[model samples]
Target: MYDVGTRKQALALVSQGLSLNSVSRQTGVSRAAIRSWRTRLEPLSPRSEPCPRCSETPRDPDDPPAYAYLLGLYLGDGCISPAPRGVYFLRVACSDAWPGLIDACAEAMRSARPDNKVFRVPRQGCQNVTCHSKHWPCLFPQHGPGKKHEREIALEPWQQRIVEAHPWDFVKGLIHSDGCRITNWTTRIIGGERKRYEYPRYFFTNKSDDIRALFTDTLDRLGVEWTHCTRAGKPYNISVARRASVALMDAHVGPKY
Candidate 1:
């Protein structure tokens, strides 16, 4: 890895109106690396806009409902990390199978980071919705140095309050990311005739016990009945098979598009 001084020198030369090729040749750094540094090292304040969590008078997100949803998405399949300079990137991955889910993720991120630009990066079968800003950590206090499952994930008091108020939004976000609605079928004989029946249920699977608890706690508050099940011989699934609870989910979360 190049030293910080090397990166700074290269950035300085590029700032002086030097073409990337000229900067690369003079500094012996690859043009691609120079371009990457140029984008991250630009003279921009992480707080070009007022941050709700970090402004002079700290407050909750302007759009608490959207933030609640985004929080669930983060816990399910999103991450925040330091970018070059003082910037940080927040990214949420959505499967291509559900293009509408991708759009929803983008909308939530836009709502959360109204001042920053949102980007979509395509992977083999998924799209990553991301934004760059310095205040991601301020909003997501649960962020840390390891896999979410490996760490103890707990919401700040403020965040818990938001979730309490917008539990459906939070549940939808998590379901869209790491949960699904599926049909389970069985055959039974009735009156000497065999009939096939199907049961609609919702399943939320995550390795992190804390995340699972967060989900169940919200469900409990909402009076939605749920139970643990072993799927594929793995005991990481939370199943909601009660007809009333399924109706609640259908009315709110629905099948992910």
Candidate 2:
């Protein structure tokens, strides 16, 4: 990133038709690092503000259980869905709606009873904010409001088998999750001066309350264990949480479920 004088320059070089790997090699940054830098800088470009729909101020670490609250609201009605490629934000609504929607989802999550909560962040474009997050209408044009074409759904044979094997259970047990791109910084103190270097971070959601228990129960019932990795590459490791699913069911599922 330091080597590029302007984003246009970087983008041009990237678009001039070099593979990301090739671009990274020429630029001396890892492809992942370049991608992270792109996520940070793209939104703040001279022409655009960071997407308000996807952007939110940092939460206070000392604050009370705001984490679950934020997660719940964000997951609204708590269902998970899949993308043909992976999760990514859609450009439907004005970009300004990001933070309020983020907050709204949090409020919804905070007040909902434990059994009703769901989390469904997928492994691909989930990091794309506007694309994958339900706050925007479906990106599949045919499936958008008033259109008849439905979004293509995915459930690998294994996932389908797992879902099928758990038929007797009741809580709609499945993997629940979502994630955000965060940049981590390392600060070094030298002679009372601090300098920070950034590393990309992934903020992933786990099922709130009984959702986790239900997921574990369901998976146990099915005799299957699930593993998940964010498209952004973060991993959830707990035995119970690991086997869970994302709760983004369908477009209508948010307001009602």
Candidate 3:
């Protein structure tokens, strides 16, 4: 089955007055699949009533830590889509390997907007936790077209305050979504004998400079030292290899459960 992203792209092409054959060719999804998605998502009438939950003003999350962390996750790998009839959708793609992080993300959405329904849609190698809320765009103004690296990402005044108050939580979310802890090995020549030693380090990889800056800035506030690197020949990376820095991160973020 095609993932939500692919299905959404097909639907978008259809909405833009593209033919089923054209959308199928562009998205590589079969024409039948495109038709199925169109039929499933299209409203019977343009005047269909909006979801009742859309009318309720979703309050800002009461827990700053949870909200701030979720914000970091959104910046890293989440997306916001405006649907028909003023319905809004928020989806965060998370690795299936990290079930705990998936649960945490879903819980955060529930806490942030209890009136709305949240569900996980399965995909190959990952799962997308999605929710519908008209207030999502207000919560995440960073939503836009194209890759994040090609666009600007900045926080609003209130979002800045939340991150500043709970920087570690923000870092935790960023690292959990886009960073990893790994072992690095090095060889040393001691008295003409080669010795190998292994050290643990944390690495965060993203294509966006602003997102990398935000991660490093949070690390700086926590007195954690890090360095810049590149991965996969293109994506920028921030790495924390120092023992003290790793310890500090451990205290705050730890490993994904």
Winning candidate number (lDDT):
1
lDDT of each: 0.88, 0.34, 0.81
Per-prediction tally of clashes: 0, 35, 0
* Clash-forming residue pairs, model 1: none
Whole-model lDDT for model 1 versus the true structure? 0.88
Better-scoring candidate (lDDT), 2 or 3? 3
lDDT of 1 at 192: 98
Residue 220 shift from truth in candidate 2, angstroms = 17
In model 2, where is the ten-residue run with the lowest total lDDT?
A: 248-257
Q: Give the runs in model 3 whose Cα sits over 4 Å from its true position.
A: 1-60, 232-235
TM-score of each: 0.85, 0.20, 0.76
RMSD values, in order shown:
6.3, 22.0, 7.5
**What are the per-residue Cα lDDT tens digits for candidate 2 across 15-129?**
3334678777676667776566555623323332222223475222222233233232223223233332232232111122244443334333323222222222222322112
For candidate 3, lDDT tens digit of each residue in 1-257?
98878876777666544578988889899998877765574543334223322447634457788889889889888988876557678888999989999999998887677666677877799888888766787777788888787999998777888899999889988998888888899999999999998998999988898989888887888899999886766649888999999999888888877
